[model samples]
Target: MTFWFHMNGVGIGSLKVYTNDQSGSRKLAWQRVGRQGPDWNQGHVRIDTDVQQVIFMATTRFHYGSDLAIDDIVMDPNPLVLTTVSQTYPSTASQTYPSTSPPRRYLTCDFEINLCGWEQDGELQWELKRGASPDRTSGIVDDHTLLGGRQYAFFNGHKAVNSSYVARLDSGQVFFQPGVNISFWYHMNGAGIGSLKLLQRTPYGNVLSLWSRTGRQSPEWLKAEVNLPPGLYNLTFEVSAQHHFSSDIGLDDIVLSEETIS
Candidate 1:
């Protein structure tokens, strides 16, 4: 099993992992008993015992208003394999969107085709801007982003106080196979008051969130990946801002692929 962990305002705390096997007894599998800073950390363990259950616990000796968050927990029975199916990016005006229907193949945008057939909300605001500028030259959407020739769709809360935007693709367009995964690179390192989410339209017409992130994460591009089951779904990219004009977000290098357990 593997997982990501984050902590905030923590002091004199201990993180421990416990496990129980068919013997019906508990034992400590792993632990981190000490002080820690607020940051994103990851952990993994190889359970040699026939573990019946696993437990994670955090104990604080003093009351310091601490917080802990966990995400991206994967417990696959077998080591899963991944194969790339498509990498979608439209660079020219004539380049068209890839068919959304079976073998779903395409990306959201590189900001070359002017949003690349993506529909956006007017209030929240999204625009294609040069990836590199005096104020925003450090963290770009992806490694392929050029200084002046390439651009990315960004939501910089320039004139808005509290903002929200929804960018979506209609349904019945892409055919996603079973065990396929979607991924993208995002830049969310501004005022630490922005959020980004990936959602999909269910068959019954309900939007379900697959993955999400909020606040500043380091000072560079980050990657978000979600494994999806076989289905025809409409994907949506949602962005929101809180407070001032410093909230900024960027997106690029969207990819969908199949996972084969090898």
Candidate 2:
């Protein structure tokens, strides 16, 4: 049987799949396959292993120093686990709560109109981001945006690095893995992309996704169903992103859950 480990979450999106053999002690181990997303994904090490369990981990780090609107993490290890039932955002007065997880946001031009980033309210404020422009909102309702930017986010020989520039998301402990569906209200522009995905691969070799981007560009927020891939995952509303800045993409009301096929 194909056991899928699924998980999904907002902010520093991550999905930790612990495959402990039936021994209840034997941990799961996965070899390197590939990568996705525009984050600084790290490599995985046999962090620890013994007659008890073997543990291998991959880390994804966002570059574009801006908070993104991530909703879930899905991985299909055995059954599936996606969609965050409920969460509590502590301190409404703070932008980042409990600065534990390093910020997963890295930009290119630092913003000014030349470059843009993500946000929590789906707003883009580079300057307010630290070393760019001011905290500004998208002047346009990019339900169908056409962003035009270079491809800085990609999977490397084993490391997915947006070395120079990449998208961003809030900093916290949010993960996705071993699931079947991830619903995100995404918008796209007319531009195109090499690939736009909900999953961002890293060197450690892991699939942190719940319906990701392998292709690029779409004019509307349509649902995407991924069957043949690292695993099975689907989308409710059709959504697309050419993985380009000019392709203007925005995702809102994202829900990571199983979309009934009835």
Candidate 3:
């Protein structure tokens, strides 16, 4: 099974999986998983035994800087728990909210021309381009995108101590739906050491991290999904890199809707 979580920083703890033996004694199946630095980490463990439960233990040298958050736990074929029935978002809507009283819109951004009015900031270089080239000589194309198009959010690492970029919605947007979810396509490739985080801003100016992943997830574009409570919220997309000039990260097709998949 594979699980995703936000470690925030290094030296946190470990997650253990356990199962019962034939003698009815509890035995450890797998143990000790952690991510380096402050970012999200995806962990995978193969259990030969019939797993019973999982446990998380903090090491003796624990530094309580950031809390651990886990989400989107997945196995190859299926999952342990189901969250939603289906996943759908209205892509054609111009505005993020519905014209009616109850609010019925699915916000979308393809990065064609920055029509969505998203804000950008931080150290890592971010821009909209047709696509990135995968080459070593030019040192430009660190990774290839899964979605082929005329434009996508291309995040490139530069020669700097800190490398990061943030794309977010401006504050004070009203969302009246009972349930809402945010989804996007991201391609984190190459030999870079960085992390991507999906954050939500509340009405009281509080920022809450909902989902994240670190390092090279895959060569192809991967979908990241997160559920939000019914209320007003501002979304922020953040990518940070530790090593300079490692590789490039690509983001495209962002959607916010009242749908999810279990």
lDDT of 2: 0.29
C-alpha positional error of residue 233 in candidate 1 after TM-score superposition, expressed in Å: 2.4
**Using Cα atoms with residue i matched to residue i, what is each candidate's TM-score against the true structure?**
0.51, 0.29, 0.52
Number of the candidate with higher TM-score, 1 or 2: 1
TM-score, structure 3 vs. true: 0.52
- Model 2's number of clashes is 70
Q: CA shift at 128, candidate 3, in angstroms?
A: 0.1
lDDT tens digits by residue: candidate 2, 1-262: 1122222222233333344654576443322222213443322222222234434354444533323222233332342222323335675542322212111121111232222222211111111111111112211232212343312111111111222223333211223333323333443333332234554433344545535553434545555444312232221112232332333344433333333423
How high a TM-score does candidate 1 get?
0.51
The TM-score between candidate 2 and the true structure equals 0.29
Candidate 1 local lDDT, 1-262, one digit each (tens)? 5566655454546666678899988876545433334556555443433799989888776677556666787674532122233554676444333334322322434555444334443344466666452235333444344445676666665545545543333222233556667667787766634678777865456788888888777567677778875565556687776645556677766766554333
Cα lDDT for residue 114, candidate 3: 44
Better of 2 and 3 by lDDT: 3
Q: At residue 185, give the lDDT of candidate 2.
A: 43
Q: Which 10 consecutive positions of candidate 3 have the poorest summed lDDT?
A: 78-87
Candidates sorted on lDDT, descending: 1, 3, 2
